[model samples]
Target: MTTTNDTRGVASQELFERCTQIRQLLAAGNANFHAIGVQYNLIVDTRLAEKAGFKNAPEFLTQQIKELSRSTLVTYGAVARAFSAEVCSQYGVSLLNQLIVYVEAAGVELDANDPSTMLISVPGADGELEEKFFGECTVVDLRKAIQRLRRPTSSAPLPAEVDARAQQCSAALTGYFPQQTGVRVEVRNRKGKAVMSLKDVPLEQMEQIAALLSTALRSSRAA
Candidate 1:
């Protein structure tokens, strides 16, 4: 009877032969490494799908790869094709995955023509939006700049009555829209007049607010 060792040896030899053939094909320029890498990633992604009852890995990986900076993706793809996964692991390719979040949080748009520059929007001291150019920035530098930009600038306290009115407005809005998560309402005294501001209010909520105001106005007129 044939032993298990013989079968194992045969399988190993067959795998080695297939790898040699593939190497020769790639060397002769008859195979495309880019296409090969994509196919390989797809196969691995499929195998990784729904593993341990989690289906998010494949989709998340695809989206993360898609969202990488164009320059980073180009560099990574070249390195990946030349040395495959080993070079990617060595070069910390995961850093590219965080590029999107950094750019978005910085509230800046990347210049596709020049990755070293960004278009940033900042609010002026007078409450006007200002567009500015941030040049000569790498990904890490841009992230640091964004962190500084996001820091709170105002330390002044609100007037007591304005603060109280703001809190009352917030509480009333919350009570009115218990299911809404992002709604904000603020009421402040500005030059002896009440100024109200609403932010992140949903469209449906805005419509409801309008209807309620119209009803209140009609009832006041009837009185």
Candidate 2:
């Protein structure tokens, strides 16, 4: 029974190793193919379909590579050859997948100071551009970090009255919390209800703001 268990374990380990090897090879091949597609400009040119005896490029690819999805082809082809190669080699295919989504959404810029760092610009709640940095890190970790940074936390198209109130609140608080620069209050109307939000206030600053509010309330009560 012991020998049988050992043999099974060895077989499982071998299979796992083989799968890993195949995955890596597939990643490398995908990167190479994408680089070629970009260089040849075949990804976007639908006219090439007629020459290739197909109705369209999508049709040609679908028939030729039935297993591959059209979205994957387009995404891979969209990446710049240089960036694709670097991402695939250094970060592996998993990171390349997430990087493609970022590239498509808002675009990515290489950090001037550090070649290994990628800089993504996202819109802050205060209507300012905020930079999110991804240094040398695993794909899973970087993806999670980037997703958190990019997630939209605020509601949009507030009612005119709510918007005006939010603006007034922001202006009033700016005077009290001059040290907390670049913070804005947003008022959103949802289902006839008003929701107030303070954008980008750290915990310590929030405590300070709370104290100020408490003091003001006490003073009003005394008056």
Candidate 3:
């Protein structure tokens, strides 16, 4: 994978141990992402990379934080910023992130503490909508749930050609980003739909991806 390296850096066992803590804790299961975020925040906030002679956090993270991808590190920060340490203590980090996405995308008012039910104000939703708790929602389940919410208003089902084309586009994105994690691309037959999820992409690459999409949209309009 192509990593953006910081200017020359010296190795520090202390920093290495700090980075390694993320891996070690996660492996033990039930990792508290907020705690991991604290360490990630420290490294970035204090510019710990420079202490090791590296120019930026990306370089330090990529080189020093081995095995774990940049996306995983970013999730630590997301969970820390989005939820309390107490809230995140029991929830898996991915679940927390997905819930945030679901709320934002679905316009659903949710109590993170009570995942079993939520009050979503959509076209026909009335009062508190009794729903399954989301602790077990896989990424694919997330996409389907979102789609179902908008089903009445959603456009026609994705044509097979479009689905195939979208798959190709997703593959191209993977080829280009290479190091990204937790990406999901699915073509559901029953719904004749395709969903491509790109989450936890590193901050540095986000602008590039956004710009690429914007440019494509412009060209499409012009054409």
Candidate 4:
């Protein structure tokens, strides 16, 4: 049960609050993101949409919540299921979304008491890889971390010469890509069902990368 302590900050001399923004705002313009998300969960969970003569959530979205995109509703429920109001406000909408994605994709929970085990490679001050938690990392760092985690795990070792040649090719290609492109190329070479993926990249950046790929493929012989 949520006691007075939970809302007032500090778990009644027990736990410390990491996120202090506790006021729940449900006003249309105010957007207490996660709290609104909680309402979303309830609506879907209780079949309120069905009662409203909608075939499904998508229909409900199209008919009533014209402004709410399908993607927003999906992620909103995820955010609501994942964290409390305070954590949602503290992390902000983007981070909370990333948090859910990380946990689901990595198959691990975010344990506040044991953030050490959650350690992953993140860029340090000197621009070198350092292990850190999501809370400790900047937004850019978290994005990089999620990308690293989602990358396919190699099942077998490549021959030394092939690996070296690939590294050189990668370096060359990396140098050619402009930093402003906001595009990334990933090679998910691994045994089994591993597939390439792009996470959280904007559509404009994706279109840029797609254009590059189209140009490259046009010149190359059919693979």
Winning model by TM-score = 4
lDDT digits (tens) for residues 125-147 of candidate 1: 56564555544334454455455
Ranking by TM-score: 4, 3, 2, 1
lDDT (Cα atoms) of all candidates against the true structure: 0.47, 0.53, 0.63, 0.56
Error of 4 at 115 (Å): 7.3
Alpha-carbon shift of residue 126 in model 2 (angstroms): 22
For model 2 the local lDDT of residue 43 reads 30
Task: Residues 36-60, candidate 2: write the lDDT tens digits.
Answer: 4452244345244444344655555
Instruction: List candidate 3 stretches off by more than 4 Å.
Output: 1-17, 23-27, 50-52, 107-117, 120-140, 147-223
Task: Write model 4 residue lDDT over 112-157, tens digit each, in one string.
Answer: 3333346557655665778776667566767776776777667666
Best by lDDT: 3
lDDT of 1: 0.47
Cα deviation at 199, candidate 1, in Å, is 29
User: Number of backbone collisions per candidate, in order?
Assistant: 0, 0, 0, 0
Candidate 3: lDDT of 209?
Answer: 71
Off by over 4 Å in 2: 1-31, 50-53, 80-87, 103-115, 119-135, 155-160, 163-223
Give all candidate RMSDs, comma-separated. Answer: 14.1, 17.4, 14.5, 14.2
Which segments of model 4 are wrong by more than 4 Å?
1-31, 112-118, 123-128, 158-189, 192-223
Candidate 4 or 3, higher lDDT: 3
